[model samples]
Target chain A: MNAATLARTRGSLVGRPRGAGHVLETLAAWALALLWLLPLVYAFWTAFHPTEYSTHFSLSAPWTFDNIVHAWHAAPFARYFVNTVILVTMVLAAQLVLVTLAAYAFARYTFPGRDVAFALVLVQLMIMPDVLIVENYRTISALGLKDTILAIGLPYMASAFGIFLLRQTFKTVPRELDEAARVEGCTPLQTLWKVYVPLARPTYLAYALVSVSYHWNNFLWPLIVTNSVETRPVTVGLQVFSATDQGIDWAIITAATLLSVAPLLLAFLLFQRQFVQSFMRAGIR
Target chain B: MTRSREWLHAWLLLLPACVLLVLFTHFPAVANLWHSFYSTPKGARPARFIGLDNYRALVDDPIFWQALQNNALYALGTIPLSIALALLMAVWVNGRIRGKGFLRLAFFTPTVLPMIAVANIWLFFYTPEYGLIEQVTKGLGFASHNWLGSKSTALACLMVVAVWKEAGFFMIFYVAALQAMSPQLAEAAAIEGASRWYFFRRVTFPLLMPTTLFVLVNAIINAFRLVDHVVVMTRGGPDNATSLLLYYIYEIGFRFWDPAYAAALTMVLLVVLGAVAIAQFVFLERRTHYQ
Candidate 1:
């Protein structure tokens, strides 16, 4: 459903009375919400304030960008950012192309072994590449692609979730559209590009957001595969930076944490509705 | 197009994804099983087929047992609480609650943040003597306690982080399901003079079963899959109390340089997840008939 329908549904469900119990419920919700936001809020506070004021809350505490500056300079975070950007972009680009073609094949064509192939593909959903880290590392090192951003993104390039979501979306396209496109002398790939792709924009958007966020946040695999600053993504870099003997500088640690997540957090805050809706759309399927 | 041509076209389109999936997903899975029967090759020594020696060792490995038990406890502790909190958050946000936008934003914020980053933030929160929790406890006249260092509270502390990180992500699904619900049921219940709790218990809860099941499967998978916070906050500290299956595998495979043992450990994880997958398929089949 679209935004308007969700809004209408919410509006229709909002006819509760303003009694004492209702007030208490509201208070409880607010309390829980505040509690949920506390760690993040504290991180922001610690990151912006001086180290002395990390655990000391004061309304008039001085705020500065020095922690962020120090955090930026303390590690090769700029390189890490570049590496993360390359990694997520490579993964999303490859996944979109691969998922699109695979989805189109499954959605429109009859082929031998299609069901078996589909089942095999769905195996990734249950047993993800994350769990098979040991063997995948051997394969990656065998290929001599160690300590590269490509190694970080390679296993995840063929995403089962993307393929599944896009396949479902493609199946919803009318056969008439496919026929019309083919009748116009379009090839199978052309039919996919012209007919199906344009209609599944929302699904593409949802899948892209989910994919980007997942790759951007993925740590363990990247941690295992990549070795150098040039290859480490933001998550791994942040880990290495913090896990080093930095002597527990909470300000710089929190600042580095914030810096690593700033891009995604900013994106979420900017597109709050789209972010929530995209996650909902992605998860529902 | 002819049938052969159609098949060829589909194969051509499917070729890339299938190849990659085989190389990465399917191949590694089979290889994990194959390697588990062998021994890890040290320098100047080749791996020899050991025929379940790794499995035998795993049976005798206390760390393996602890990791398994910890994972079970982690899943049992976190799943129900997160699911419950998710339902509560969904109901509150879906209703015409005051500041609905703020509540929704607050709840869903953690979902978007990188778990590693949030785990680092939590690491700070759990630090002794001067951390936020300690500060609050001390301010309230309670003795200071090492939340993450002590064995008894370490896993529980990590579980709290897991719940905090995941409950919001799960809430969105419940919200989607709640919105899809027909308002007529609620209207009918109201006309029947049913209390809100009674109506929720009798009608809303049952209708949300599919969503609950769906979230339950996802939550279960996440419980097994996610060890980021564990790696960040605890590193299975205080005598392996927080070591998860995957984390243990990482230690064996990477830290200790033992691939064969890790493979055997991975087989256990794979088996657990395989069972979950089969259950999901069965539930999904039943759910289709339910609709």
Candidate 2:
């Protein structure tokens, strides 16, 4: 039988009674979902409403843009936004180029020490740059790139996850495509660009989404490597702002928190399905 | 072209990534070990060889032991519950439930927000008297309590936030795996008159083992690696009750300005992760046989 009929049969057989148990299960799911969303909903509630209503949770609280506006002007958030954009873009761009090249080589070529090299690459997956903060800080300082956007993006540029994902995708490409491109006088790079890259577009998209969200939300390394307002991303900036101005205004703090997360949140909402699917695709391997 | 030329081409292509991976990952890892054997240089005083001194300090440090214990507890607290919740979420979303779309959105929404940002919101939620939890419990006639302030609840509070942030991200993987599953299995189970729970326990759960293993490894790594919430929510405070190993490393290396000691602490984290890596490799190797 087809999938739909099979699904219907399974549903009928499994959910045969469709009585209190099903209702309870549904209630439990919705309740969990609501509980899961409470913090964010509370964030939005506190952000848009007046400060008096932050803890009040009144339904008729007055709404205003004052908190977000105050938050935006409170710090050099515009600069923070610019720095974050540059950092995420720089990291993603470098990752794409480097990972594409490395994955291309690993996927299609056989060479000396290739297994060892691949194993070395995979080592980064476990001992991530996040944990190497101390030595990396020293390295960045030694290279005199400390507190720059480049320093923030540098350590993450050669992402093993990206390379691994792309390598897996590239392996699935038929060898005939490579031969055809070569027979047409295309060089290896050209063959990769024309054949492998085009076919692995889904993987590229998935990796890009995962990488962007990761670096966008990344805190500690940027927090460590950057000390200046000129270099601090929104996460660190928000932390500095909130920590210094501790507990004075929940409205403003929540507003700053919302501001830092707004762009990615909006993107996820707009492309919710794609974002979820991309994460699923990225995680499956 | 020729084999030698092809090798040259491949090496050239791998050059950039290899250089970076070594510089940032491998080199620092080795340097962490090398630095851990020495003393941190003071003004006009260079780092001198002090073999095992830092390691000895690590063994004797109360805070180090506390951080290690907290990290272990944090992992134990977060992993199983999040994975269970993720599987339940994936199953529910994959089922023909009403408003599953909205439920999925709600569940996955937390995965997108920055932990630092949400930590602020949760900080508010855990506020002493006026926080949401406080307000609710007060309505239920409970006394006031500081959720994040108390040493007892601080790490547990952080673990809650970690689970909130991670479960949805992991659910996506399970959802993908569940969708890829053949419906015929369920139909076959149903035709055999097996109960839903029995089918799930016997067939569905076993089938999801690979996904579970994958998620478990990621979860374990994340437990060590994720300090954003700890940094934001607690800063390893309430007498270091919330200090994970990496957070302690950050505190020692940067805040305390003792990279050598921090490197020693980092060696401990590296050993934990290395152990995790080997376990994962063995698990994956064994799993391949099943496939």
Candidate 3:
């Protein structure tokens, strides 16, 4: 400890110590955090305040649901919300099934090019689904999936992160369980379905949450693939709201922005701890 | 009889994802390479093959080169700022305190929300007339400036927003790494009279290298892919001031209907991303060797 901190902790009267470094670091961090969150807080402020006050910040502005109400009537928000849910659910469901099966295979059964194939599979992380927009756009078009909901999701269903996460999680499972299952006449698939999947629940949850957040916020691929209102996800819908040649209205745009973020924000707030842990587990493995 | 069938069944279990990967990812990559040399004729029966001609034109395309430079500048700007902010926040959140969860969640909240959503909202913050930023600035008696309108300021403004959106998510990784550290080392250092700064610099920072490398790769990847903000907020505006490489690719391939040339640009991007991925693996291997 420095003399300042030492003096504070030791209660020295003449040469009083202070936790100067500690206080300085803590203050800087907190200030930087609030500064970092300024835009979010700005959004939050704008979302809650009434229109006409949208451009201006006022401490005592008259608050109303007018912007949200105007925003609700302005677009097919309910439909957009439903579509986002369905899209996230469909993608996550497929990822869970496919990644679990593949992860189990790579983890338990050693096969030819197993390492190479796994490494190749990880190439998806470096080259995102967005990067191959030309090819995915072509691939989706070829699959006769243009402008459909599934077109927006089909490429992402085989998630590299999903597979990698589950593989790591499965590696942590004890070998004895596999042996015991094999001795008990459990086939490999059954051993995987019964023992490994259940054992990797936290990881499953983590990857699922990550995938959902990822796809929910995903816009570019969805933008290129989905065409009309019937299949549009929330982000695309929000984009189309302001993507016009005419002068854009700040109130309506902010309202639409608020609508897009509300659901995931609500979800994050509710599952705050698990949501935080989920990201950590993803990074750790 | 069933023993050999079991091996086949194991392959069967992997078929769904394997097929999807091959069809969507692997084939498209090959096709992107293949299609980069051809132009689809509007009324003709087939695409005209022009080998290396499109790439030759790309080398001379000033717009493409400018966008590429902007992308590099963007990558350089966002990577270090986000990484530094993330580490700083991770240290703060990792400290012994009440409501660390709340603080961490606050920091991470942006990662979960739509980037386009936040970008649309932040657009107002960068707006010129009656925007929040302008209001703040004009209120201070300084002449107001369009934050996203000027070529010089627009890209930097976007980078600030990007780092804000990304840093906290990166911090979670560092926090996890910090928490995973054995507390005994810190206590030993404390007994030997290491201050918090000293403890962090000497003991804590070196130990967090793995997480730092992971965050570095992820941050770079995120910097490239997250053009949703550009699409929503600036749309590569004010003379393509904030035109990033991905957005440039979108403009060239899709907007300009020159997929042949766009594919060449994407090849450049693929090389960049591949290099980073290789560097990450090298970092991992080196760390393992050191351990």
Each candidate's clash count: 0, 0, 5
| Local lDDT at B273 for model 2 | 98
lDDT of 1 at A92: 95
> Residue by residue across B1-291, what tens digits does model 1's lDDT show?
899999999999999999999999988999999999999998999999999899999999999999999999999999999999999999999887799999999999999888899999999898999898998899999998999999999999999999999999999999999889877676666667777788778888899998899899999999999889988998998899999999999999999999999999999999999999999999889989958
Candidate 1 residue B42 C-alpha distance from true site, Å: 1.7
**Candidate 1 residue-wise lDDT, A15-118, digit = tens:** 36468988999999999999999999999999999999988989999999999999999999999999999999999999999999999999888889999989
- In Å, residue B153's CA in model 2 sits off its true spot by 1.0
1 versus 2: better DockQ goes to? 2
> Model 2 over residues A214-273: C-alpha lDDT tens digits?
999999999998899999999999999999976559999999999999999999999999
Which one wins on TM-score?
2
Stretches of model 1 off by over 4 angstroms after superposition: A1-18
What is the docking quality class of candidate 2? medium
True contacts kept of each: 0.77, 0.80, 0.59
Interface root-mean-square deviation, each candidate: 2.0, 1.6, 5.3
**Cα RMSD to the true fold for all candidates:** 2.1, 1.3, 4.1
Candidate 2 lDDT over B212-248, as tens digits, reads 9999999999999989888888889999999999999
Listed in order, each prediction's TM-score against the native is 0.98, 0.98, 0.94
